[model samples]
Target: MKKNLWIGGEYQSASSYMELKNPFNLEILAHIGIANQGDVLSAIKAAEDAKDIMTEMPAFERAEILEKVAQYLKDDREECARLIALEAAKPLKAAKSEVDRTIMTYTFAAHEARRIHGETVPMDAAPGGQGRLAFTIREPIGVIAAITPFNFPMNLVAHKVGPAIAAGNSVVLKPASQTPLSAYKIADYFHAAGLPAGALNVITGSGSKIGDILMKDDRIKMITFTGSPEVGRYIRENSGLKRVTLELGSNSALIVDEGVQIANVIPRIVNGAFAYQGQVCISIQRIYVHEKVFEAFVEKFVSETHKLKAGNPLEEDIDISAMITRGDVQRTKDWVEEAIKNGAELKAGGHSEEGIFQPTVLVNVASSEKVSCEEVFAPVVHINSFRHFDDAINLVNDSKYGLQAGIFTNDIHKALQAAKKLHVGGVMINEIPTFRVDQMPYGGVKMSGMGREGIKYAVEEMTELKLISFKTE
Candidate 1:
């Protein structure tokens, strides 16, 4: 069945349509209505008109509706997972995990809705202000433009939209063109959960056209986006002072300290590097091993990467699946070839066919090579050796991105030092850089984008602080 645009709480068709397909199998899923500039205008207008209605609703009421939506998601978990797999080419196993996380995202949003508190300011402390009591109140930032990426379709969308609604703001969602079905499912869940009409609208079409409309529109007070750094920078510059939360790219690093337990680390390193085909922003792309443990770590890591089964996403045995498109697969292959040409040693699984790229492991990838420095949104990882702990930290910090980094060391002193010295947003002592929860403060430094993204943190970004004071005495 063809899918229509969810605008103003109604599903309607457009004159033109976009044919949605399964990139793994090339099967036609549906033709979503191609929203034009006019459609985008309508969505913005609808959200603007619905602002008072959303703002006037009590926080408890918003919490109830968000909780109901979370319940609805839990009820239709399998179907939602299937939709994510079909649309994004994520393996069903990983897709199910994403749906589970999406459920938790909304649940966290519900929890935060009731507890969105403000702070008391010391206005009277100033010499001029005597007997003036001042406090801060958080208010919704009006209509928000939520633009999500193709990877982690559901949860990323939830990270933006759930918090926007919880903060009492209407949203105009522009989901990735490849994975609009999941956004449609989100819209249905919200609408069925008794959300006010026009409070949440989903428009599916050309990202450039619709995004330009949203970026230029003054009605949208804020924009939350997750995508490439180039596009993120463009949005930031062009939005012209609009409040924006940008979650961009990363070539995340993981450091294997000397004498770490290899048996426990191998499986985690494999999963962190290749899970979701490394399309994740903070997916482990670079590994720096202490020279003493380099050879052993590489051997074990290769062994684990070999055990992964790649096939159709629906298969239970599959560990990795296809990229979003063949073009992406080819680009990954090209990067591998370029790295190999520049003195990198290919260790295991560098071949790709159809849309599935094998979990590739490389070593000796120079810092100047594309694979070592750039965000490889593919199932690829590079291993290099460092002489000292400071050397390892320096190598990891030598990139344009500082999203997240991990260190595997039992040394408490080393771990603590690295936590402070590393230039990323979050540091995991024993876990992988890919470790993330729906409730933790997540985002990065440098080119990895600005601001925080966990449900509570996102609520802060989606709202503005207003100073309320009263004069007495």
Candidate 2:
């Protein structure tokens, strides 16, 4: 397939193009037109031109457009899923799930479009303010620049673009070059749904070249990004006065307490650690099990993990597949090897074939080891024992990236206590850290990120509050 850049609701080609290859096998899936810095500037100009059109549109009209886009996606669900799997090498089942979530995200945005409410102020409470009437209103911040990551090309893009549109803001999107087909399809949906020209523009090319343009443009009022902490920091520092919402990386942890049933949660743990090749930001990387149930937990966890099938992502039963690139596999392998050299014992499956690394489990890993400390964006997990609940909380909070943590305990008091003391964005009681629905306020503390990402929360980030007051004589 040949994909063109979508700018101002029109598809166009450039002189240079890039080929997107399947990560599992070096097969060219599609050729996407590349946008230079000049093209990026054009996109920014288009979004700036659409500011009045977006702001003047009625909320019901905006909601209708978003609903139509959601219907378009549902009409072509299988095709979208196949494109995601072909470009990102995600398993077919997981790709389908992602498509479902993307549909829900747009639907939620549609609902939020009509629900932007403001509250009236009580001026009578203040002295000399008897006849004054005051209230606050939310308004769009104009042009938004959305930079999305490759791991979740469809849904993460939806998280940014959907909310921006719901908040009545025009957008210029920069999808990851490695996976631009999904973004292209979404742009087609927006156009087909009768969104006005220039309301949404999708640009594809080198992130550094186009990203710099997006950041430096004064017309852009906000920038929303999802990537590494290093890039997030750069955006924060350089985005001068523009509102920024960053969804950065994480090394998520999970705790298994003494009273938990080992058999009941083994499957959840296995899926949490290995799903989508463990490329997700909140994929389980560090696990702390209470000493009383440590042996039983490891035995069942490794047994279930080994049962997962590794094969072509197109297959229905394959649970493990290739990483985004061979470089990622190599980095993950190097970390695991370093941990082993430092006296960590490999429990099962620690090798690589082609671009796929086996779902690996390690024990006795030191807290300072690379595999334990760093964000290993591959299918590898480290399990350590903790004697008490306090010890488990300390172990989970020891890392710099406190995105989300999970604790399993039947006692309500223990679970509530852990929720209060975990030092992360979310503490899942009796659930895995990978648990996330599209409607919740999702973000992290410390190095994880700077803002939340649910549809309503994201709309808040994309807008600004204005106070309107009047004196009634």
134-157 in candidate 1: lDDT tens per residue? 888899999999999999899999
The lDDT per prediction is 0.92, 0.91
- Model 1 alpha-carbon miss at residue 180, Å: 0.2
For model 1, the superposed segments whose C-alpha errors exceed 4 Å read none
What residue runs in model 2 are displaced by over 4 Å at the alpha carbon? none
Cα deviation at 442, candidate 1, in Å, is 0.9
Candidate 2 residue pairs in backbone clash: none
402-465 per-residue lDDT for model 2 (tens digits): 8889988888888988889999888899999999999899999888988899999998888899
Best by lDDT: 1
Where does candidate 2 have its weakest 10-residue lDDT segment? 7-16
TM-scores, one per candidate: 0.99, 0.99
